[model samples]
Target: MRTTPRRLLAAMAALTTALLASACGGGDDGGGRAASGELTMMVPLFGTAPDPKGEVHQAVEKVVGKKLKITWVPNAEYGDKTNVVLASDDIPQVMVVQGKTAAFVQAAQAGAFWELTDKLDRYPNLKAKSEQAELNASINGKVFGIYRVRPLLRSAVLYRKDWLDRLGLKVPETVDELYEVAKAFTEKDPDGNGEKDTYGLIIPKWPTPVFCSASPYNVIETWFGAPNCYGDRGGRLVPAFDTEEFYTANRWLKKMVDEGLVNPDFATLDSGKWNDPFVQGKGGIIIDVNVRATQLYGLLKEQDPDGYGDKLAMGGNLKRSDGQKFSYPFDGYNGFLAVSKQSVRTEAELDEVLKALDRLATKEGQTLLANGIEGRNFKLENGYDVPIDDDDPAVKTINNDVDFAFVQLGTWATIGMGVYESMPTSEAERENLRLRKELAELDLQTAVHNPALPIVSPTYVSRGATLDPIVSDARVKYLAGEITEEQLRAEVKRWYDSGGAQVVAEITDLRAELGAGGN
Candidate 1:
C-alpha cells in the first residue's frame, strides 16, 4: 500500500500510553559502547522469517561482529504488535518504526529515541543518500531515523501484447483509447476462448492514497487531471476528492463498471484476489508496479507452457485529455530504522548499532546481503554474479528469503537498479527490467509530488484514519452505482465538515512556511 506520514501517525496513535512506558528500560549508561556485542531487533516480515541458523544469517552476524536476536512479525499484525511493544517500553535495541507514525513522533518528542540529525554526518554511507528522503522522515524538522531508499515512481499499465496483436489493436495512448481497448478485450473474445469470459480491466474494491501498486485508481485519476492525494487550488491546498477533476474521474470509472468493461464485483473484491483474473487468462489489463510484469509473465508461462503468455508487455503512461501525462510520486523511502532509548540506553550502544548499519550500506555488505555467499548461492560468470540453481536448497536459503534481515538499513536505488540487470538469465527477464527502468524514468519527468508530504496535521493525526475509509467507501459505492453523484458530493462535504478542512488548512500553512506556491 502507498503509506503516508498521516496514515502511519494514525496507526501509531491507536495504542495506549500506559502500555508504552511499562517495560523495563535497557541497562546501558549513555555511553558509546555496549557492554556485550549483542543486539536485539524487531522487523515486519514480508514473508516467512528466515532461519536464523541459515548461512545468510551467519554471514551477516560475521560481518557485523555481533550476536543477533530478531523477532519477525507478520506484516498484517506488525502495526498492532509494534504498538504493544512500544507501549511496554520493551522495544528491541534496533526496531523498524514507521518514521511518520504518531507514536514515534510522540516518543521522539519525549526523548524516547536518539536524535540522529547531527550523528548521521559521521556515517558516510548513510549521509550520502537522498537528503529529501531524510527530510521526509523527520518530525518537527528533526531527524530521528535512518530511511530505507525506494524508487520515487513504480506504477504503470501492464497489458497482454499477444491479445492486442490478435485483436489488431495498438497500445492505448489516451484515456478514451484505453476505455475502447478494455471494451474490446471484454466483448471481442481476445483470448480466443470462444466464450465471453474475459474482462477488459481489473479494479480493486477501494483504490486511493495510491498505496498499493495494483491500485488502478491513481493512474486513471491522472487521466482526468486530478492531483495526487492533495491538489493545488489558487494557493490553497485541498484534498484531491474536493476537485472537479476527481469527480469526473469517478464518473468515468463508473461508466466502465456500467458498461461491464471492468469486473462487476470490484467494489467488494479482495485485493489478494485482484490479480487472479489476469493471471488465469480471464482479464486483459492491469495497472500495477512494473516489476509485476516480470512476475505475471512467469506465472502466465507456468500456467500455460505454450500459450501466448510470453507476449505480455508494459505500456507507457497515457496522455490525459489535456494533452499532458502524469503519474503519482511516492515519498522516496520505505519504512525507516530507529533505535529505542528504552533498549539501547547509552549513546555508545546506539553508535555501535549505527556502525553495523553503516557497514550494511557499503559495497561488501550490500553484495553479501543481496546475493548471499557468492560461491554458495551465486558464482561469477562472465563478470556477473549468476544464480547457481533456482531449485538448489542452499541457493534458496541465502537468497531474498533472508534479505529482510539485513538489507533495510540503507539500500540505495543505484545499487538495487542493477539487481535485475545483473541477475536476469533470460531475454524476457531482461526486457521486463529494461521496460520498468524506462517507464520509471519517464514517470519521474511527469510525477505530481504531494505538497503535503512533509506537513503534519493534527486533525489528520486524530481523525484522518477514520475519515479515510469514509471517503474511499463513498467513492467505491458511487462507482458501483450504489450511491448517486449528489450523495457522493454530500459525503465529500461531510468529510470537510468533519476534519478534512483542518487538514487542508494545516497543509496550506506549512506550504506557505516552506515558501512553496500553489496553483
Candidate 2:
C-alpha cells in the first residue's frame, strides 16, 4: 500500500549507542540516579514535534523513573519511512506504526526488534492487560508489539429518531420500512423546514473499479441483516459479501439510486463530503461511521448553532430486518507500538515507557486519560469532566498542546459507543451518551463484530502493492454496474488467484495455530 507516516519528518539526528548512554542512561530517573536521556520516537505527529514532555510525559517518566526525550517522526508516511529506518543499523528508540504487519513480521524474522515476551513481567501493567486481552498483536506467536486498547464498536444504522416520531413513523427495522422512511425523509422534509429540499438518506462514497476496498456497505447490508464486509455466524468466520442478503442490499442500493433517496455520489463521499448533505439540512437519513457522527453533531451546532445543535439525535446500531446487526469493527485497530532493534541499547529505559503505558491503562490513568488534571485540565462536575467552568487553566493548554490525548490515552478511542458527552461540562450530554451507549450495546449484542479476529496489521507495507488495485477496480465496477454479480465473484476469486486468497488462507492458518481459529 502507499505507505503513510514517512512524509512526516526528514530532519532527524542520527545517534550512536554512546550518545544514547550518555544522554539517557546516566541521570536522576524518578528520584534515583535513574536514566536521563533523549531518544527519538517515531510518533504519529510529524512537523518537528518534540519528544514527549510535560505532565503526560512526566507521568510516564515517573512510572519508569527515567526522563525520556521524545522526537516525533509522524505516521503520515510511517510504513515506508520505517522500512528505510529498518535497513539502516541506526534508528530511532521506538516507532509506533500504523500498517506495518508484514514489515514487522519480516523485520522480526531478520532480528530487527527486541523480543519482549519473556521480559514483559518487568512491567506488571503491560503484562496483566496484555495477558488479560490475550494480547496477540504479535507475529510468530511471540509478542512483538505493545497494543493500545480502545473501543471495538462499529457498523450500526443511525436515523433521526425525532424525525420518525414527528412523522408518526416507527423506526424501521425491516428493509421495506427503511426504504419507506428514507423516501419520507425526502418527501417529508423530516427537519420540518416546510421545504422539500431534503433527500432521505446518504451513503458515504466507496472507492471502486481499481481496488474493491471495503467501504460503508454496512448501512445497507445491515438493513438486510447481513454483514457487508465481514461478520460472524455461529462464531465461525464469514464474509457477508457472499450472501444473497448482500445482493438484497445491493439491489436496495440500486433502487435508492434510481429513486434519488441516497446521495448519488455516495461512492465518493467520505466523512467530509458525506456529512455535507446532513449539515446543509439537505438530508434526513444518513449513514455514518461512529466517530464521524460525533464530529457531525459538533459541526452542525457550529454551522447553524440553532439548526442541528440539539436537533440531531443519534442511535445505536440498528437491527437488520432479520434481527441481525452488521458489525463494522475491522479486526480492531493495529496500533501496536514496537521497539526497533536500533533502540534496544537501552531496554531498561524502554521498559519504563512501557510501565507508563501500563499506568495509563488503569483507573487513575483513565482519569487523566479522560480529564487532564483535577483543577487544571478539568473539574469533576457531578462525576464528569467539565472544562467549561473556567476553573482550570490547562483547558486551553490541553486544547492547544495535547493532540495525542485522543489516541495515547483511552478517551478519544473510547469516546464513541457511549461517552459522547459534554466533557468538563456541568451536565453530561446524556442524549449524546445515550445514543452512543445504545449503539455500543447494539455492537456488543451482535455476534458479528468480532473482537478476536487476528486481523492483519494495517501496515502500509507490501500487501498494498498487490491488494490496492484489485480492491479499487472491484469496488468501482460493482457500484457502477459495469460488473455484474458474476464479475464481482470473478474479481474476488482473482484475489485468491493473485495471493489475496493465499493471504486470507495464511491468516486463517495462523489464527488456527494460535487457537484463535474461532473466527
Candidate 3:
C-alpha cells in the first residue's frame, strides 16, 4: 500500500529498468478483435483486483453497454507488466501508462501505442479535459493519450486555528510572519498543555524539489523566489539550485533547524508519518496537499470524537518579503490512458473503445465511478448523495471495485468536493472541503508554470534517475548545516560535471524546437 516514499522510489526505479530492457516491437497486426460489444483493458490497481461479478462492475457494464475483460495490475508492478505485455504483443485494447517516464516515451516513439490526437476531437467529454494536461503528456509535440485530470495546484499551510485563537496570533501573511508564527507556536504552548513539547512546524523528509503535499521545502523555496525547477535567466533556462534564490532558501531552512523551530529528524522522517505530531497535538503547522486536511480532520475526530475536530485550518499563497506570492502548478493529471494498436487491431475497434471511454467522462459516468451504485452505496438527500451503510462489507467491496474498473476521465476536483460535502457527517469534514476549495482558488491566482515540464531532455531521460538523488542529498545536507554554501555549490558543479549541463543544453534546444520561450 505504498508504505514508504523510499520504497516507492525504489519500486519505480526497478520498473523503469525493466521497461527499458524490453525489446521494441511492431504494432498490433489487427488480429484479435473482441467480439461485438466487448472490450479488454488493463489498469493499475491500488489494492487487490475486484470481482468482475460485483455490483459496481455490473453497474458500469450496464451504463457503458459493454461486456469487459480487465487485467488489474498492482500499481507497483504496472510499468514492468505493461512493458512485458507490450514486448510480447499481449497488450490489452486499453492500458494506463505513466506518460512522463522515458520507457513510455520510447515505446510511443516506436509506434507501440496508438496516437489519439486526431481521434480526441470526436469525443466531446475527452476533448473537454485540460489542454495543459494533454500537453504535459505529449511526446515530441504530439499527443498520444488521454490524460486523467487533477488539480493544477493545491499546496497549502495547514494549521491549528483553535491554537492560533488561544495564542492570540493571526494567520501568517508573509514569509517572515510565517517564521514568527512557527516560533510562537513552539515557545508559547499554544496547546495549553503548559509544557515546552509542542513544535511550531513539522518538516517532513523530502527527497527532491518536487512539490510534495507533506513537505515544506518547495513552498518555502517558491516564497524565496526560486523557480519550480528551472528558471529564466537572461533568456536561457537554468536549474533553480544554480540561482542565488535556492541558496537563500536553503539558508532560511538551516536557520529554522538551528533554532529548533521544526522537527529535528526531518531529514529522515517518513512522509506517511508526517501528520503524527499534528494529530497528537505536538505540532501546530504543516505544509501539505489540500486533501490531507480532510484526512487529518477525520483522524482527529476519530481520536477525539467530542473535541479537536474544528481546530484544523488551511491557508496558502503567503506573500514573500519582496511582495510576491506564488505556488508551483502541477501537470494536472494522475497518469494517462493509452490504447494499444496490437490489441484493438482496427480503427473501428478503437472507436468503440474510445466511445466507451467518452461515456466515462460524462456526469453519470463520473458519479458511478466515484460513488458506486447510488442506492447501494449512497442515497440522495438535499441534492447530494449521502453514503449509506458505508461500513458494510458489501458496500466496502463494491467501493473498492470502482477504483479498478475505469479511469476518472476528467476534472475530479469538483466531483471530489461534491463527494466530500455529501459524505462527511460532521462540520470538520465540511470545513476541510471549504478550506481546500479556498486554497485551490487562491493558488490558481498566482500559480507558476514550469517551462520545462513538457520538454523531455535526452540527458535527463538517461541520467536523471541517478542524478536526482545526488541533488536531493546535497539539499538536505545544506538545510541541516552539514554542508556550507560553498560545499553546496561544489555539489551542484559535480551535478553539472555528471551530466546536468548536458541536460540543460538538451532542454534548451528542445524548448527552441518547440518555440517555447524562457519566461
Each candidate structure's TM-score, on Cα atoms with residue i matched to residue i, is 0.88, 0.77, 0.90
Which candidate has the top score in TM-score?
3
Model 1 alpha-carbon miss at residue 214, Å = 7.5
Q: Which lDDT values do the candidates have, in the order given?
A: 0.71, 0.53, 0.71
Which has the better lDDT: candidate 1, or candidate 2? 1
Q: Candidate 2 local accuracy as lDDT?
A: 0.53
**CA lDDT, candidate 1, residue 312:** 83
Model 3, 104-222: lDDT tens digits are: 66566666677887778998877836666666557656777777777777778889887888988888878888889889888998888888988788977864443222247766777
Writing each residue's lDDT as its tens digit, candidate 1 over 139-220 gives: 6456777877777778778887888988999988778888999999999999897999888888766534322222577667
For candidate 1, the per-residue lDDT at 226 reads 80
- Which 10-residue window in model 3 sums to the lowest lDDT? 1-10
By TM-score, rank the candidates, best first. Answer: 3, 1, 2
lDDT, candidate 2, 311-377, per-residue tens: 4555445555656554544334446666655455466666655665566455555554444556665
Relative to the unseen true structure, what is the Cα RMSD of model 1?
Answer: 3.6
Give the clashing pairs for model 3.
28-342, 30-345, 213-288
- Using TM-score as the yardstick, the better of models 1 and 2 is 1
Q: Give the Å error, residue 262, model 1.
A: 1.1
